[model samples]
Target: MLTSLYVRHFAVVEEAEIGFGPGMTVVSGETGAGKSLLVDALLLLSGARADSGMVRAGCERAELAAEFDLSALPEAREWLRQEALDEDETCRLRRVIRSEGSSRAWINGRPASLAQLGELAGRLIEIHGQHEHQALLSRSHQLALLDAYAGHAELVQRVRRLAQEGRALETQIRALQGEEDHASHLALRRHELTELERWALAPDALAELEARQRRLANAGRLAEGIAHLGELLDGEGELALRRTLARAQGELTRLVALDARLEPWRELIDGAAIAVDEAADALRRYLDEVDLDPARLAEAEEHLARLHELARRHRRPVDELGERANELRTELEALEQALAGLDARLAERDRLRRDYALAAAELGASRRAAAARLAADVSALMAELGMPGGRFEVMLETHGEDTSLDLLGRERCEFLVSANPGQPPRPLRKVASGGELARISLAIEVATLGKDSVGTMVFDEVDSGIGGAVAEVVGQKLRALGSRRQVLCVTHLPQVAAQGHTHLKVSKENVGGQTRTVITRLDEAGRAEELARMLGGLEITAETRAHARQMLERAQAD
Candidate 1:
């Protein structure tokens, strides 16, 4: 429900705030008193189009802001949650329209697009008038209302899920069908992978063999270095030292006499001779261990080349050749099974389409049944609203030849009405009289309000054409409707205005050469004056005031 509406610099309303409560609320005013201005601002807040001409003459821009208490409206909360915009259990819709025709929207303090604001506000309020009641006359809207009346949301949801699944299946089938002419293309790709599949490659075989090849290519230098080292350590210096030491030892016997240092020199030469023999033995062992093989190295290099070439062609690492082979083999198996799987999927799609047709047909039958009840209830209300024998018809036409797939369950529907008794029933849009049409439309709306998500219903001058008892009946009905939903009525009739749980009167005044609109909530005494003014026009007679007081007392008694 709307908590308050604030309009700043909009039309004749420089700044105004209107608070609303539940049950029937009536707004009464003299002509050109800005009651319609209040309604217009609300319409903009509800996502209606804005006009630059309505901006206050001196203001650069006009701002329209409306606050709604949505804690009780779970559907709206859920919608906001889905859109990720629910904040503080309250929805604040604001719009800024520049005098240059630029407009902007905000939801919950976040800047939003006008389209988004419109969608969000659509779930909040519904304004019904003689001009906008044509929405209930829309055939598609009527079908939705009928479905809602039938309480078949679960059934419709099931159908919706089925329809969604059927669409997905159809898309998959078409994608597979598009691939039907690609068998030759697939075959070529398979052959390419198969060519690269037959390779016997081992890792690092090339690098290891090349290292061994280099060693073999330098075998002569290694052999020469070994021989030269053996000659220097054994034959040249170590052997000569051993022979000289033995000679010195033999001479030392006669000169043991000369010094003990001579004896130490002989012992050192003996150690050197042992070292020379050990070095020559190690060199002989080293020469015996080197075996070079060029042919084996060549074979490794050739195999490495084949693996590298295959890897490059496939854009893979050389070590990944084995993995590539396995992948290609698996893909070949899948290709062999593709035809069977595609056939099964296509068959399943057809089966779901048949199931969808059956379920949707049942739903369509249920909607038709519900539509009849709706028309009867609305037709009854039309009679009570002073349009006796008004004919309200719900027409459902089946479209397309019988087929598995269809457009919107293949049903085209229309809601038709005739306002007068014995008058040929015609399309509602063809009606000429405003008040009769307004009543007929409201009757249908009240009947279908249960199916509609509109939390607030505003009726502008719907009680225009009738008076007295008829006016009382209209007020009673509007009041009765208040038990189920919020209703705002703009009226001049005392009985109608007196029907409200809260009444507000709009009046105009001239202050400093400018006309301004003022809205005041009527207290007990003020209520009598306002009601008296409504009953007796500009002059409030004593009798009229007394009558107004009595009317207020009677209204309160109810």
Candidate 2:
């Protein structure tokens, strides 16, 4: 439940800290005294849109805060725990609106987004504006209210989920069936695969083939070069390296016999002659192996040209042709598998349809049961709220079996009403007067009591278009609802104001030449004076004061 609200530089409210208690609390004041400012403040704290105009004239920003006790609100506590914003059993929500049209929010002193604040606020309080009856006219809103009253959250969510899944499955099925030309696609892929396979070459094999081509292409040059090298190393001419080295070695041997130091030089010349002989042998072996084969070279060049052409056609590197062929093979396999799996997918779609039908059927049945109870309860409350013969009904119109899946179940919900006896119940939006709509809306709200999990319910002038006994009944209904949950009502009706377990008086004052709105919690004497002011209009007489006191006493006695 809401524990307190703090506002500073917010609109005409310069600064105010008001503590709230459980049960019905009525806020009353003269018109234009900013009676609904409290409600507006709570709305802003709940993440409503804010603007620079909401700030006071001399202030840079508007600050609003609300505190809640979550001892009985497990949902709120769990939400706090999930968000890591839990601070014992109390939660504080703060919002700052700058004069520049930017705003910031916090939950338990932790910076939070507007969406987060709204989400948490939803679990803490529910504010019903004076114009809420306007929304109640919408068929969708009516259905939502019925669902809430029926405690069909889990069931409605299930039906919606099944319907969504079924629609998604239907979309998949359509996409699969839309592939009517799959056979042609498969044939094209197979033809491409076959072409790729025909010229597929491993990377290493391609490298080796290119090397062989280079070697074969230069065979004549290589043989000529090797023959020249052999002549230079071991030819029979006197100038050849081998003969020169041998003659040098003979001379060195003759010198070595004269001096032992010359023996090492003679051994070095012998090693040179042996190295020249080894070179000549190696050149002879290489020249013997050299082949001038144009046919093999031509074959390798044509193969490479074809591979490059294929790479150009496929927009891939020549080395990646093998990988491309593998990819095409996999695609062909998938095409075959997709064709084989079509029947299975169709079967699964059927299963989803069946599941959706079952869930929607159950939802429809529950709605019918809940609708009966809700209509009866609202009708009974309508009689007590000064509509003697009025009747309320929840009409469900079922859709055809072939209709597309709907997230709101298989039927359309419409609220119908009859304001007079012997009259047929008509759609609420078309027939009910504004006062009647307010009463009926209140009746529905009262009928659905205890169904909402929100701990606090705020009604901003919910008694807008009714008066006298009807207003009294409205107050009683709110007071009764407050017994189970906290309720705050902003009203001008004396009867309604007198019904509050606590009363707050809103008044405007000019302080320091600046207009400000002030809210004061009323003691018994203060309550009587405020009520008398509401009952007596601009002036309060002794009789009006006595009447106000008696009204408060009577409402409390009840």
For residues 383-495, what per-residue lDDT tens digits would candidate 2 score against the true structure? 88878899999999987574477888888889999977888999987863655766676688789985657799887886776789988998999898889889999998998
- Model 1 agreement with the true structure over 53-111: per-residue lDDT tens digits: 87888789999998888876787899889888889789999999999988998999988
Q: Show pairs that collide, candidate 2.
A: none
**Considering every candidate listed, which one attains the maximal TM-score?**
1
Each candidate structure's TM-score, on Cα atoms with residue i matched to residue i, is 0.72, 0.68
**Candidate 1 regions with alpha-carbon error over 4 angstroms:** 132-134, 188-340, 404-408, 429-432
Score residue 419 of candidate 1 by CA lDDT. 83
Query: What does candidate 1 score on TM?
Result: 0.72
Decoy 2 TM-score against native: 0.68
Residue 489 alpha-carbon offset, candidate 2, angstroms:
0.8
